[model samples]
Target chain A: EAGVTQFPSHSVIEKGQTVTLRCDPISGHDNLYWYRRVMGKEIKFLLHFVKESKQDESGMPNNRFLAERTGGTYSTLKVQPAELEDSGVYFCASSQAGVGNSPLHFGNGTRLTVT
Target chain B: AQSVTQLDSQVPVFEEAPVELRCNYSSSVSVYLFWYVQYPNQGLQLLLKYLSGSTLVESINGFEAEFNKSQTSFHLRKPSVHISDTAEYFCVLGADKLIFGTGTRLQVFP
Candidate 1:
């Protein structure tokens, strides 16, 4: 089976510009997650989706960041008025739903550089 | 609240040598421990996990991790590592949500 794939492996945008990162999860996976790492910090969870439904979004940093999963397929994370602090790697992961022990499969990630 | 700590930021070792990467976590509830390896420009790959029963977990790549509740650690070890084993290893804990450590970069020299 194909793994999770992401688009635009690297993106460069100005501080106030808008950018959208896409994540194509593995086929038949119901659980999708988004995480980000800034500078040299650890990867932090942003949100999760289960079949196009928002499971949890408590990790979202602010309202400027919006995420959506349409048709229970690919997911998109859009950042408006991107800040310099948003420059980092954004990783997308997915796994089988209702299975706590199931491991997550991640995409190569999109490296966003906001100047 | 939970957090992970990778004590070593980088570890350099000669090929075929044994190595250990220490990891510690703080959580009020029981957690599932995991070890993931990330090659340069690649996504994170699951190496092993300790979900319950048998405090020791082994990976197909000869990597193993022991979950110690007393120490609140899940340290990964490899008895004999090759150059191919070089990668950044992250120790993570998963509960209602997943939490990860900063990661430790392992470099194997020939």
Candidate 2:
């Protein structure tokens, strides 16, 4: 089985631009998660999705960030009017079960650079 | 709120030597502990996890971690490490969401 896959391994955008990151979870996996890691910082959770519905989104940084999982398959994270602070690696992960029960499979991550 | 701390930011050791990476967590509620490794240019992979049952957990790659509830620690150990063991290791605490440590970068020298 393939692990979680992220699109556009690296992205460079200007401040105030919009950027969307995509993630395709492993087959049959219903639990998807988004995390971000700024330079020299620990990875922080962004949100989670169970099928087409959001399980948790308390970690979202600001109103400019939005996430969607359509058809209960893939996920997309959109950052509107991206800021310089948004430059970091965005990781997408998926698990076979709910949180704390299954091990997560992560993608290579999308590195976003805002200038 | 839950938080994880990795005591060492980087550890340098010679090949075939034993190594230990320390991790401590703070949480008001019960949590699951995990260790994940990321090789160069690769994604994060699960090394081991401790949800319940045994306090000790071992991975297939000769890595082991013991969860000490009393101390609120989960330290990873490898008796003998290879050059390929060089990577960034993250200690995570899972409550409502996953809280991660800054990570410990292991560098193996021959």
Candidate 3:
């Protein structure tokens, strides 16, 4: 089976611009998650989606960032008015079951660079 | 809340030598532990996981991690590592969400 797929493997944009990253989970997977790793930092959670509803979004950094999982098949993360600090690798993962029940399959990630 | 700590940011060892990567976690309740590896130019992959039962878990490629409740640790070990073992390994704690350590880069020289 194909693993999770992330679009635009690399993106470069200026500060104050807007950027959107997309993720397509494995088929039949209901749990989708977003995680980001800043340079030299740990990968941190961004949000989670169970089907079309968001299960947890507490990790979202600020109002400028928005995530939507329409129909629950895929997810998109948008960072508006991007800041220089927003440069990082955005990874998407999916699991067949909830947190502990299943292992997450991650994508290669979208490397975003904001200047 | 929970957190994961990978004691080593990097480990260098010669091929066919033994190696250990330490991971310590902090949580109030029982936790599930996982080790994920990212090979060069590849996405993250599950190396092994420990949910219950045996405290020791082994991956197909000879990597093993032992979960120690007393020490609050899940350190990975391999008696004979190959050059192909080079990669970044992340120790993760599974709570309501997955909390990851900063990651340790394993560099195996021939």
CA lDDT of A88 in candidate 3? 96
TM-score of chain A of 1: 0.96
Q: Which ten residues in a row have the lowest lDDT in candidate 3 chain A?
A: A67-76
Ten-residue stretch with the least lDDT total in model 2 chain A = A95-104
Ranked by DockQ, the better of candidates 1 and 2 is 2
Per-candidate TM-score against the hidden true structure: 0.98, 0.97, 0.99
Q: What residue runs in model 3 are displaced by over 4 Å at the alpha carbon? A: none
- Single out the weakest 10-residue window by summed lDDT for candidate 3 chain B: B1-10
**Higher-TM-score candidate among 1 and 3?**
3
Scored against the true structure, residue B4 in model 3 reaches a CA lDDT of 96
Residue A67 local lDDT, model 1:
98
Worst 10 residues of 1 chain A by lDDT: A97-106
Q: Compared with the true structure, what per-residue lDDT tens digits does model 2 show for residues B1-110? A: 68999999999999999999999999999999999999999999989999999999999999999999899999999999999999999999988678899999999999
Candidate 2 stretches greater than 4 Å from native: none
What are the DockQ scores of the candidates, in order?
A: 0.72, 0.88, 0.93
Candidate 2 clash pair list: none
What would the per-residue lDDT of candidate 1 be over residues B2-100, giving only the tens digit for each residue?
999999999999999999999999999988989989998799998999989999999999999999999999999999999999999999989877899
Q: Which regions of candidate 1 are displaced past 4 Å?
A: none
